[model samples]
Target: MAAIYQVDSFTKLPFSGNPAGVYISDVEQDYETCIKIAREMNLSETAFPVRTTDDNHYRLRWFTPTTEVPMCGHATLATSWVHFTELGIDGDIYYETLSGQLKVSRIGDDLKMDFPSELPFRIDLDQSIGEALDCNGMAYYSTGTRKLLFEISDRKKLEGLHPDFSKMEKLSVGVPLRGLIVTCKGDGEFDFFSRYFAPWVGINEDPVTGSAHTVLGPFWSERLGKDKLRAYQASQRGGEIRLEILDGNRISIIGNAVTVIRGQMLV
Candidate 1:
């Protein structure tokens, strides 16, 4: 039996941030089992970390209820948190995932993740997207994460705007989009503000998305003229993300996570 846990990423409190299922096992988990467990967990994404010969290194995979994703930040953070705090793993943890080799280092209570940066390319706006989101802004597409980026004019609009999710879903499938990021410049303590929606991937609204910030980090860095910035995800269950733009087209995401649930998978 493997040990399974539920963790809230990017927040210290339970039921905040983004919740992800973490499955820790020594034996290899197959594709069918991964999906089954992911569906059972029913979080935005689940992290399955299978140990390799190296104690600190793992082969990690992430799955949504409906499909596997190439990258997932919050789940990765949850998995590393479990390893570092719960299991007493030491030093920097390494993950061999669909996004290539990634590393996480513990910084006191916070964890910093070395992730690949995804620079978004500007694309012509789709009118249907405006109808779905009920707002209009610049549109960009990221090849690395397959997330569509939209920059609205104000934070209030970004926070207050409600989308017709059904129409949003239709647009995502028809346009073949994986997720949508609605973002704007923060007017207060945070440097930027954003929200994530991905009905096409079984997540209607992710509370705090680390993967979305891969695109957000660079998008803001260029405009803000700063390598390091603070960001807030304005979901109902909100969360904060600290970002640093790195050389070689990479990014660093920093946050804390709390283990909200723990149990053994008996099967």
Candidate 2:
């Protein structure tokens, strides 16, 4: 049996944001064990944080129900929330992940995560993808993280998309894709609004993604000409994110998480 923490990331209220399972351990969980735990939890992603010899640094990994992903934002936020609140960790928390070394810090009641800024490379829109999303794409960009970004000129079209998940996966037959990001320019409320779909990674839709913002923070900043931006993920259980572009190609993702369940996984 192992302890498991359920946290609602990118929101202050319960059941209104992306829910993630967090398992913190002194020793690393094996690949099979982590997969089993993630499957049991059945969240979009589960975070595994194994302590390192260093004081505050840990090796962090994320897994979906069926496979492991290179980076996960909500799960990472949930893990940090568990540590800072439940476990009583004090100063900055450091995590070594597949993406790179990540750092989390506390500011008042919110958490700030330092992630690499990836301005996606422009690409020609795939007609099949446009058909799958049922919307005309303004521009398309692909990132090194294997995330595909499709920007639409109209926010209403971005919000009203009903994607065919099966076709979304099939459209990138020869391409390596982790997920598809659909976004548009926001109107007064936020700088932009987005929705993420990842049938390829076993998640039909992600409620609130933090990693996706790394690419978005930079992409929108360049277009809007601002270093600071606010975004909203227009999922059913919506969430908000505050972004700040830092020096040296990095972005700060700021959000609040609420711990909803404190229990043990008896698997």
Candidate 3:
């Protein structure tokens, strides 16, 4: 048996942020077994962290319901939350992942994750994407990751989107990206507002995606002329993220997480 925790990342409140399953094991499990467990959990993404030879370090992997991803931000946050709050591990922790070494630390009530910045390059908007989303945006861009970033002109339009998931999935077939991010200038307390859709990766809409912000932070920082920004993801279950573009092609994603479920995975 192994302990599994369901944590809501990027928000202090329960049921408001992205939920991820964190599976901490005493022994390393094979890739197929991890995939099977991820399928069983059926979350947007599940994280598995195995102990490493180095003290305070672990090899981490993330899996969507359908496929394994190279990196995941919310799941990583959930993993760190489980380690700090549940397992009683303290101080900074290092995660060795497919994307390389990632560092996470606790600060006050928030958990800060140091992730690589993936700035997007401007690209011509595909008509199929417009057809699938049924909206127009300021511009379209693609990051190194398998994701496209769409900058809309209006925040309300970005928030009012009703995408055809099947159409999106069909259109995204064979495309190198996982999903699309629609964003716009925010109002009031938020500097930007955005939403994420990745039907190809088994997630139709991610409530608060930290990894997507890795691209967003730099993109918006250049346009808005500010390195630090407050962003809001306008999903059904909305959440917030504090984004800062750091030096050396890195970014800091700051958010709070709450554990909503704790149990042992009997399987």
Candidate 4:
């Protein structure tokens, strides 16, 4: 029997964060089976725990309903929560991912993830990408993923702005992956608020993306002149994150996890 645990990552309380389905098994499933199960689960992402060098260390792979993603921090955090809190695995847990080794540590009520940094490079804003999104924005940039970072003259523009999904899908085809639209100094609660659209990758909007923060957090921290910052994903189903810029190559992302559902699956 395989056990499936439903957990909400990046929020301490249940029903408040990104929910992920985690599958634990003694034997790892083939790639096709993993993708099939992930599609069936139909969560933002599903994590599979594979054999590792030690019991405390394991390999994890993340699959969206449509395809496999290289890495996912929120799902990784949820995976850690299930292993540590439910399965009673103690200490820092190590996961070998396609993106490389990731370390997760439990600190009090928050789970901190040590992940690699994805720095954004400067790019010119042009009408081509804008036409692709069919939204008016002032500026843009590109992280590992294409980004539309615009400064709104008025915050009200944010509340009323909507992009054409068809245009966004067209824009995504031009770029290697989907693009993210972010507004700086628009929300008073946090440094910035963002909406991720990746139709190419099968996600319209991710509730809270910890991996994306691997790029956004440090970018804001350096600009804000503070090592630590608070982030909010302004999706209808909102989520929050506490980010700290560590050494040049690493970052510490702090968020709480909530276990929403627990069940067993026959494999």
27 in model 3: Cα distance from truth in Å?
A: 1.8
Per-model C-alpha RMSD: 1.4, 1.2, 1.5, 2.3
Tens digits of per-residue lDDT, candidate 1, 164-221, equal: 8888877733345789999999876899999999988898899999999999999999
Per-residue CA lDDT of model 2 for 183-253, tens digit only, reads 88889879999999999889999999998998889989999999999999999999999999999888999
| Residue pairs that clash (backbone atoms under 3 angstroms), model 1 | none
Candidate ranking under TM-score, highest first, comes to: 2, 1, 3, 4
TM-score of 3: 0.96
Candidates in order, TM-scores: namely 0.97, 0.97, 0.96, 0.90
Candidate 3 per-residue lDDT, tens place, 162-258, comes to 9999988877434487778889887869989999998888899999898889888988898899999999999999999998889998999999999
List the candidate numbers ranked by lDDT, top first.
Answer: 1, 2, 3, 4
Q: If both were scored by lDDT, which would come out higher, candidate 1 or candidate 2?
A: 1
Candidate 4 lDDT over 193-255, as tens digits, reads 665665667887777888878777767776788888888767666788888888856888889
Runs in model 1 deviating more than 4 A are: 172-176
Q: TM-score for candidate 2, please give it.
A: 0.97
Best by lDDT: 1
